[model samples]
Target: MAIRFESRTVDGVPLLLAFPDSNGAPWPTVFWFHGFGVDSEVHRPELRRIAEAGFLAVGVDAAGHGRRRLPDLQERIDQPHEQALRTMTRLAAQTAAEIPGLVRALADEGIADPDRVALVGVSMGGYLVYRALLEPVALRAAVSILGSPEWPEGDSPHQHLDAFCRTALLSITGERDENVPPDGARALHRRLDEQNPRSVHRYVEIPGAPHLMDGDQWAVVMDEMPRWLERYVLRPAHTTPSE
Candidate 1:
């Protein structure tokens, strides 16, 4: 097991990285994204929990938050006033540009498997996961928490969802979530459903859960995530649209 804190310039953007310290050899890697407002601390336990389950965990604090110390356009867009679509678009572009470089660096560090990587993101991070889905890079799986695919008032993406994207996806939502209404989940699911066109995807709506149920329902997620990872992302081969 090995753990390290490192930094690298990805597409000219300075990015931060945190990896697990463990005994597993050539473990699977998790490319993690943090939720809005909160720092990396909010995601630490979740990463540790996943790492303890025998996977490499690499997390980034979305440029502005935590140690990265850059302007967080997402949070800035969420200010008291309404934000323009262009602002969100720029942030999303920055995110997409930096992610691949981050993944490459992790692979070079022996902290991630370029072929067996999975993504788990929360809230705003969840939205970014969908954005990543449209990426041409190889991704084994994605787990998005309370993120919506529907436009956030004035949000858009880098490109249209490719009909070729059959990447395994698991979008989880809390039934009682005030932050993400039921309609949003349904819409996102519907969009992905359309994007895949011929493939069947998985969407889970947990009952009696709230916006941040990490504390209350952590136990259920701990039990369920492994199977989700095993069935779709961690199998012998990465599932493709053609699979």
Candidate 2:
């Protein structure tokens, strides 16, 4: 089926909405978050592919970036590596805080089925997925590509393990990624595995890949991600019973 893309702002958040051209009502939705320094526009192809795979896809500009770029953004960008990471950490938290409301708003507007929502993020956006998992929203599944759940200074993002247990999760990282470290991603998978034995949890390490993936790696991600979501998140049989 063909897909259509629309750019809109909801509650001050700039978003790109992708849906099938067919008149489908209250479609299942996947929220896509982009990497640092880039906006939703950069992920249009991926978002559209998701929509093509029978989802109402949404891409949001994270706080302090893209359409919501902060006034001190240039200064912050010029900060030391540690400082920049800290700033992004805070911003990711804020963005995660806003997601539930955005989901509710989409539901209220009859744009998507709130109960059938998932999340996908890359790099900085991937870190936001970890933050969002700490929240109490009813996400069916989530995917983090080239990202880590470990915060700086040992601050954990696993406080809401039970909530996380209720959703299927896929973590993909480059085996050679020094920026985020693949070890942390593997540890996260192990922790989640130990905590929730029944939930669908997968951690994939792309061989010979770096912090930034090449076109082939992205092709693999684009192909496998939507299928994973369809099997574990969209299909009714895979739904997690409420705790």
Candidate 3:
């Protein structure tokens, strides 16, 4: 079946929803969040992939992006280092706060199987994945690409490692990335390993890859990400409760 697309506003949050045209009610869902300065539409390729895999894929716009873009958002982001970091963190926080509501609205509309939900985020959106995990939302798994667990202005993900134990996580980073170094993600994996040796978490660093990944680099993510979601999110949902 062909893919179906919808431009929706749920609970005042704008979302670009994609799913299979087939009658797959209550589908497993993957929410895709784009990086800073880019809107939801920028990640349409990934959304299409997730939808092709039989999951309802949603692309979310950050607070100062897409339909919510502020007139001076670009200007604010181009400010001096310290000032720009503040603006970025603020936008990330606002975006993270909307996840729960968006998830609920989709489930209520019978579009998503709330229990089989997952998230995939790039850069700024990756920060949102970590923050959303700390909230009460029951995200089954998440893939964070080129995103850091540390928030310079808010509660860093390191401060709540316990929250991560409940969900499967795959953190991918570029070894040569200076924009968002891989060190933070490395340290996060180490801590989680120490805390729960059996936890469902993995971190991958692409050799010679930079923050702005090339097609070859993204190929690695495309290969690994869907498998992670299949193992942790999709496979689990299909199994019998007794299993």
- True-structure lDDT of candidate 2: 0.83
Poorest stretch of ten by lDDT in candidate 2:
234-243
lDDT by residue (1-243, candidate 2, tens digit) is 678889999977889999866566688889999887778999888988888877899999999888889988778867998888888888888898889889998999998888789999999898899889877688888999988787784445754566557678888999888788788779878877787787678888889889888999877788778877887666773457332
Candidate 1: stretches off by over 4 Å = 1-25, 70-78, 84-93, 153-164, 191-200, 238-242
Q: lDDT of model 2 at residue 34? A: 89
Structural RMSD, model 1? 3.9
**TM-score, every prediction:** 0.77, 0.93, 0.95
Task: Report, for every candidate in turn, its global Cα lDDT versus the true structure.
Answer: 0.63, 0.83, 0.86
Worst 10 residues of 3 by lDDT: 234-243
Residue 134 error, candidate 1, Å: 1.7
Predicted structure with the largest TM-score when compared to the true one: 3
CA error at residue 108 for candidate 1, angstroms:
2.5
Q: Write the per-residue lDDT of candidate 1 for residues 129-195, one digit (tens) a residue.
A: 7777766667777777777665554434413555224566777888888765555656656776776
When sorted by TM-score, best at the front, the candidate numbers are: 3, 2, 1
Tell me which of candidates 1 and 3 scores higher on lDDT: 3
Model 3 quality (TM-score): 0.95
